[model samples]
Target chain A: MPVRPLKTKVEFPKMLNSERIQVTGKRVQLMATCLCDAFYDDVAIATVQVLEYLGCEVVFPESQTCCGQPAFNGGDWDASRKVVRHTVKAFEGNDPVIVPSGSCAAMIFHGAQIEFEKEADKDSVAALGKRTWELADFIVNGLNKTTWEGKFESTIAFHRSCHTRGTKSSEASLQLLKSIPGISIVEFGEAEQCCGFGGTFSVSFPAISSSMGNLKLEHVRAKNPDLLVSADMSCMMHLAGLASHEGKPIKAKHVIQVLRDALKNIGLIK
Target chain B: MAHQLIDTFATRLRPETKAAVYDGSKKGHEKRTKLLFDNYAKPDDLRKLAGKIKQHVIENLDTYLPATEERLKENGINVHWASTAEAACNHVLEIMRARGAKRVVKAKTMVSEEIELEAFLNKHDIECLETDLGEFIVQLDHDKPSHIVKPIIHKSRREIAELFEKNGLGAYDDEPQVITRRAREFLRKKYLEGDVAITGANFVIAESGRIVLVTNEGNSRFCLAATSCHIAIVGIEKILPRDRDLALLLNLLGRSGTAQELTVYTEFISGAKASTQPDGPQAMHVIFVDNGRTDVLASDCKEILRCIRCGACLNVCPVYRQASGHAYRSVYPGPVGAVLSPLLLGKNFPQKADLPKASSLCGACNEVCPVDIPIPDLLLRLRAKAKQEGVPSPGTPPMGGWAVMASQPAAWKAALVAGKLINFMPTKLLPVPPLRAWEKTRDLPEWRGGAFRSWLKKHNS
Candidate 1:
């Protein structure tokens, strides 16, 4: 489906009027992340829809592949830096690079900086971090689009991706979800616990990984929410996989995917 | 060589242990968060300050180490330095032999555990009894401490009761009070009969030459009071610059470890009791055990020395919660041990190399650390160090192969196309072992490989 840009200029809350107001017209480079490119293409598509729906021009850098997190996290810095250099060359523009996964975005902003710490171009790499934003953070904080007219009806148990802990993206996703009318967030005990999807950790230590995933799934199941939502699809993938394996599958989505459906449901964007 | 981490983890797959670890650590983590936040307006600032104090001391061990020795000597405490665990254990034995003390009473000390002092002393036919209730139970059961702060966090009350009954402590009684009473009654007698007291210092102040011991039970104090000869096994990293630093460090320790404002007993031992004094130890020996701490300080992860043995990281760690402490297969467990154990192994880092990979890098351990050790960062650094050392990371994917695909767009695109074959491939015949591990508990999402790139092309057109 072709996503058309929203023309209506919805006024943001008066408190945020002094902030950047022209984010709607700003062009953003989409970092579709390796995971989404191969598996969850719909999440990337929905993310583009939501960004365009906020009147921002979304640019997909086709040359971009992975964020080098897998290699970086796996202790192969030489291999990780090679992939990281490729990413640096791919998204070489000055536009803000937006990522749907908080974990991937963190790889750029935090992980890449560490990988390139000793290099001469480290300052430029650090500059890249300043311009990268997780999708929900860009929409809510960057675009100042907190008060959404679109309504979403569902009970969501939001899994705060552990990668989002240091970044503002986790709070941004929750804020966006809460601002939308008709959506009730089902709060569970130990809501901030990780779903054991530490990229390679999911596979390397599968038994322990699944056990941790099962603990999270138990909490998510206790609330019996209609959906399990998170800002990072990697976490959602691990969790949904675990939930399904246990014979009770959960409907998990990225925050942008949910927001896209909410806007589409309200006839706000086509 | 394959690392022992996974092999050790395989041995600790008991359901009862996992359940106990999960419940115990979760409650500890929650309690720490609540207590720290409720008590301090800016707990992060407090944690940062605590970290700064420990970091400063660690960085200046050259200055503090001699100063501590000087002050401790001036205060009439015999100062002995041990460069290895064997040497540390031998020093204790030498001290005991000189004093002709066969019966030893002990306070909980992870450093002694690191040195395997009790077992060493046992081989010498020296009776060493654990005075702390948790240590008593752990000694009774001949089990390694699964946690730094709580020794038997892996054991349920039922198991403790069974162990107690089997050991002839009493009939089966799972009541918490009864268990404590049984241990207290049994241990109170041993304290008086014990000839030498051995304890671990939580912090040794360089300025005042005092060793600080924080315990919920007054067992350390009892051990000190009951014995004329006292021996303290102190890790060289436990030195603090000033006594004033204890205010903040102690606050962080109590709140972070067990959520108490202060432990029940906080004793500061200045020296052996003077000639005119009534009680306390007549002679005191402090063994400064290096045992690879100096090696750790000289390494890239020197900041791990800032650890206070709080076990806050273990409580917050998801891996530690599920696998329990035995999985790490080290004297220290959880995130702290993941970094320290391997480093402490010195030339044998490969033995515990997989400890670094055992973590999911969730960053909770980093967040919960009282001294603000960047645990995840340290874990990553250790992994890198292991790779550089050619330590085998069995079951881990070859990052070089993935990097080749990721760095070149054409190869990446071709790989994406190949990823579709995963959907058709039977689980029994999956090419990658990690993928087989992945498929054990989770179904893979059907491959929609290269669809996004095609859609982007179509949409832009």
Candidate 2:
């Protein structure tokens, strides 16, 4: 089964549009992760478009690159430090560095401490760690409190990525999902389990990684949702690949994509 | 004794591909746990629960210990405390000798394994028989348990059949039922004829002085009931403050151990068989073994005392699935084993030092642990402790060499240059064989040609 790619051109608005976020000129930067930069560019675009549609001033630090999760997971602390130092420097002055990928956000938020603990730039890394937020977290918590008027009636299942859900926090994603008026969020059993895509772990140990993905696919199918959404594309890609290969009709989408699609219905985005 | 038993048992069993199956299953289990954890609760909530339980157990252990001893005594049970493994073993031996016990039937007990009880018993001329199905398999083959719960997880049915046949129990059978029946027939006689029965307690209720034993095979139940003298050996850390706590533990134990709602039998023995009860053991003894556990409890590693031995951490651990348990060369094999074994056996056991390094620090063990011991964190601490203690290394290659190198910027820069220069070299061209492990499986990625500091220096300037 061929992987289905989202065709819509994902783009972020330059300013806060949602009446829900009571933003009084606070700046938010979008962290288009390495994977988002290379493969899931649509997710980065969708994240920006949704935040813009929400009426928040959005900035994309082109100087931004990967969050160094790839190196971190591989046990290459120095390589991860290099990437993290770049990331911390890129979003230095931004109030919130919103990352669409849960794994990347987790790295910036929590993993940077471990990655740069003994480095000369540890103090700067620690500062960036304090301000980093997963995009859903930024949308739900960091956003100025505004009652969302957007509504979507479709049933969707949300998958929490391992690092985001297990290591970091999941309340941000859950709260964001709850805000979508009329959209029923179907809860999954054992939903906090990893989707088996441990970055390079999937390819390094394909058979085991695939089996893990297959189990996640089984649970997702159990919910019988119209779409599966998650904070991490690496996990979504793994689950989507298995679901597609098994001939399941369930489609995987980033949480931002779902929020973007909902906003588009309300005429908030073109 | 575990070393000897492992060598003997491993020599007899034919190697199979169960390791591969375990690897796949663990990945699947970890993925499921992550997905479920994400959807169910907040990280802070989970962390709070883990912290609360551990703190409760450690802070008032003194009060709980005496309370539990008094309660057991009130229920007509004798509680013996052993500060060391040798002390524990001698206590059991004295009990057996005083009772004139010649033959003993045993249930699964990691404490017994820690103290090398079988060897001690053998030396004293008392025959000991393992009655639990998995323990029986290991006993018959004269092997150490490869797993805490599933001792024979590394052995396929065919290999078990072969072991049984070698022992004159039956032919090499492919069916589980056939093999189980054969093991039952062989052990049933021992259960009836044995003079003493011994088992491990899953939890020791401090309020009631009751020893709670959970098992699926009914072996422990039969062994506890049929023998004249019964000895329940438990680690001191197994004590809980109240009977009510058992419900929470039992609920999580079964699910975490085997994904079942409950085991087949959950037996609670408070004391010696009541005088009115005709089938109860004539004498009941509960030996609470300290054996370095108090040291662990008193030290910074006290959180490890919270382990309930559910083995959920082992089932979900990626490194354990690959290496199997024997590689650790300890009675405790996975994450909990890696830390606990070193503490129990005194950092001097051969191959003990390698046990701590046997993980990817994936934290899957911590997640599935019902008691929520931060196993990966503990393992790291153990490694640091071992290094500080100057124990012989466990012979595994060092991981995170980069982290150490990165601690020194000049050294890191020089290492990066060397790494870039060697990136293209084949495994055969390397000066050492240790690099082969990484080279055989993964490729070294090309260096980016410049450091982040250099790039930042140019761009920011």
Candidate 3:
């Protein structure tokens, strides 16, 4: 099979302002995942800017922090308990705790309930669990009645991380992409498979990790996409690292960045 | 000796080749597992059902196990309980001797691998032949299995052809059908000639004492039918309360393991064939092996018992995809194997301690698991247990560092400061050899000064 490396830079037309006026009276929250805090802070900023541009009140809770996924996944019950307790305290009163990353949101929204079911803090866990939402899921399912005019003229390939596709069952990323006025969304093969950057597993088993990333890289390359976008930065980092190592030309960006850029071109972010 | 087998196989296969095979196998396993979960139960309903079933099984194990044994015995099948792997191996050897069996043809059985049955039988001058195509390929190459369901997944078609040609049993043709036909011709004769056939049961129905074998190639059926005596070796946890439960389980098994509506063959045998049956084994035996299952059953980690051997968890696990199965050096591999293997073989099984750290705790395995063993949880528990037992882990620093950091806040802060300083340097210059594995593939995030608590303190003050 001939492997055509994706071109990172592609020209995009200025979005029309008329479409931006259509989206109004929506509420959203920006969930800045742990990786976004430590590494990809730009993605978090873009997420907030984009949500605000869509006429949604983007609530950024200063108390909101790591989603307790690391401790929960590591089986450290005490640590997980402390983290979830803090998270529940921070976001429980909100209508919807919107998260940019699907996996972290799923962990907070779905996995936390399971983790705290019979614990002493059961009521608090249940309270927060009821309000959690992946950004796309909240936009498509919860805010579906509100129409949004997204005018982005570019080819984008969407990569669905495993947790989002399997656990959360949120296809809103695709729905949101499809709703864009001028963007052509392409599907990558095996989009749901892990990019192999499994938090700690990537470090613990590097050869196997890279091997998995190689397969994902092949998929991303096959599309010859203008840009590869995903809900999670951890996967993007893994794919981008492999792409960089292989000297491939494909650029990876968070879906929120695309939304932010498009909104900017339409003068919606002003 | 088991470690040696794994090392030999791993060395011969090499890391890159093994990695490529692992990537393909992982993709295949993931596709099948997802299809299985989607088809069998409402995606939202699986976790609840899996949790309930596992909880019920663990709480009432003593009650259910005996009920299952009694039912099997009542249906004219001999049921033997083995407390350990050695005991299980001895029990089978005793049966083999009593049957006057000199040769055996076997279907795929992880229990046999758990107890190292083939080696034991071979030591006693009896020949044991693996009949499953993947298994037979691994057997002929004298290599350990790199996958649970597909034992020879590490081998390409060309490798199989080469191996077959070297054995002088077939022509060198790099075609799957040609290789499969050659293996069938070779194993068919052995199956008919063997005195006994041994296979693993997917689930042992507690109500009927029947052993259920699920297979894609129908080789299990041939293995059970062609010999004079048939043996179904299984873990005690394979018991289900009734036949009605089979519908749900079979649905999960087919989809989770191989992504089929049902396996090519689903055979439920309660006992040996009666005199009226012309082509079935005359004597049937079901050996229920406990090994360390009872130990796991007695502890907080009893949820590991609810595993159905579907290999769904393995398919979705990122670590298993990279390292493949042989790195585990056990009959079982992947998320399920990482937790269960150490328990079954005990802490003293050489290099058994390495199994616990083999996962990324991605939760993918838990998501795909039909029975919801909480695989990542068990893996962490095993790691703690291994640390407690003072089992030396391969690439980890001494626990003294962890002890100091965990108990003393000042020490922890100091260590964090040092770690932050180290993170500022290029990862290539980090001076930690153990961390090289990580740095080779990813750049360590540069640490900003100050801890979270410190940052909060400064902002509030």
Candidate 4:
């Protein structure tokens, strides 16, 4: 399948007009994660489109690379810090840093104790951690946008990403999806289980990871959803990879893309 | 060696996992989890209190244990200390030999299993009978208990019924009730005939020097009260400061392990008998088995000692629920075993270094832990130790590349190009186990024409 550019212009939420955008200055820095930058650009674009619809200026910093979770989770603290420092430097200028991927955002948010404790600006790094938000969480809670004007309906199997617990992004995404008209949730057996994409974990224990991923597959397979959706693209990719490998009909998307697709289905985006 | 061991374990993983995840859990954990939260108004506070009491007992064990020993001695109960597994087993053997006891009835105890007590005693021509239904079934089959709490959780009902029939326990149907009744009748005979009773203490009280036990079956009571002599094996860490703490620990234990309001029987064995007492065991011996528990209490992994053996961590753990207990390769399995095994057995245990890395660090175990043991945190600490111990972790090569690429944009962009190119080839042609494993269940990323960074450049320009 070919990748297409996300439609830039859309009818913005008129309710937000001048009153709401001014609250946070409508300024946000987007950390397009390495997974999105390399493999799933559509999720990144849809995230931007979703943000644009919410009336926010989304800045994609080119200097931003990987989130260092791979190194950080592997117990290589020095290398993790080196990568994290560059990321901390990349998203500068006081805008709320929005991450489309929960895994990456979680790495920076939760890993600050080990990532920044020794740094001269440890407090600053910790402050920056507070500013970071996973995209679904940013859209639902940070922006405080509840109802969707556009209608979308499908049986969605939502994979609650592991690291976004503090933000409650997984629950927020479910609530956000419910606002869209006609969408039915297919509750899978292990819907709350991790997608087995724990950065280096998927690689380190591949057989175990693969075994776990298959269990996740069986969970959703029983539900027979129209699509597999998750707040984290990292998990979506893992699930999609498994489904597509088996020639199963299921497709995977980030929760925002599911929303974006619903809008596209109704000709809301051009 | 570590990789091979894990690979070997992975092959046998599915059957046991299928048994637990599919054939098992018909009892419904969903309702159990709901009841646990509903029954306890402040679950977190309860967990904190349980953790606090355990930590207090562990930290002050030296002072408290001697006092407990004195109290038990005054109550006509003998207290024996076992520094090693061999010593613990020998102490029980000496007690049995002293009484000239030939037939022994046993209740479920993971520690006795740890000491290989059944096999040791049976090999010496003594008849050791397991009274617990699941333990009895496993004993008949001459198989190890797959789960600490459930014992034969991996066995199907049909298998249990078949095992019972094969053992000449009569033609009971596969109905759970029928099998349980048959086991009751069968074990009642052993209970009446046995000369000595051996049981595992759920908690050994310091203030009262008593053994507190909980079981669904009433056999534990028989194993204590029906016999002339009774023996209890307990870990040093099982000591609690007061008898009142049993209320808190038992609440967490039953809810977390089996999701019960309370077990069928919560029996206490403190003193042997009064001078004019007509009932209860004439002699009571409580064996305090250290067996590396003190080492666990001394180390940074001390919090794991607070485990009341609830198996809640096992029930919620995605890894445990899928991989099952045998995959863990321990008497104790699941999240608890993953942390406790390496800590208690030392780093030299088979595949000890790889055990911690088996988890995805999803934090499920820590979330559901009754005592609030930071299981995932301990796993990470063990992973660090494993890395330092010269065991090659699968995390190294990819993370090394990820770190280097993430440090510089030029390197990252270059890697992006390489990743795009790599995604085009078949997964087998690609040279990594992670990708190979990824391709087994999930799709490799389909590289679009250009990277999102370049596409962003085009849009912005």
How many clashing pairs per prediction, in order? Answer: 0, 30, 1, 4
Best by DockQ: 1
Please report the candidate that would top lDDT against the real structure. 1
Q: What stretches of model 2 exceed 4 Å from their correct place?
A: A1-25, A29-94, A99-130, A144-161, A167-270, B1-15, B19-51, B343-353, B383-461
Comparing 1 and 4 by DockQ, which wins?
Answer: 1
State residue A67's C-alpha deviation in candidate 3, in Å: 4.2
Scored against the true structure, residue B304 in model 3 reaches a CA lDDT of: 78
lDDT, model 1, position A11: 16
Off by over 4 Å in 3: A1-31, A50-96, A106-130, A141-147, A165-170, B1-16, B19-27, B30-59, B168-182, B216-218, B224-226, B299-301, B316-318, B346-353, B367-439, B442-461
Clashing pairs in 3: A208-B322
lDDT of 4 by residue, A144-226 (tens): 88666567768887788776653567777888888888888878775556778776666656666766788888988888888
Model 1 lDDT per residue over A1-270, tens place: 011222222111111112222343489999999889999999999988877877778898878889999988989999998888888899997888899988888788777776676788887777777778878878777887776668889999998998877566778888888888888998998875789888788777776778788889988889999999998888988998987877888999988888988888889887
The interface root mean square deviation of candidate 1 comes to 13.5
**Per-residue lDDT of B299-328 in model 4, one digit per residue for the tens?**
667778878887777776766665667777
Candidate 4 clash total? Answer: 4
Cα TM-score per model: 0.93, 0.69, 0.79, 0.86
lDDT tens digits by residue: candidate 3, B1-461: 01222223444566556766666666777678567556645753664465555556556667778788788778888888888878888878999999888998899988898889999889999999998888888899999887777777677777788999999877799888888888888888887888998998998877777888888888888887678888888888887766877877787777777777788999988889877787888888888888888887776567778888777776666666656676677788878888877777654643676676666555577777777666765776676566657665444433333433333435544554576655556656766664565556554444542344344345336
lDDT (Cα, tens digit) per residue for candidate 1, span B326-401: 8888999889999999899999999988899988898888788888787887888888888888887876788988
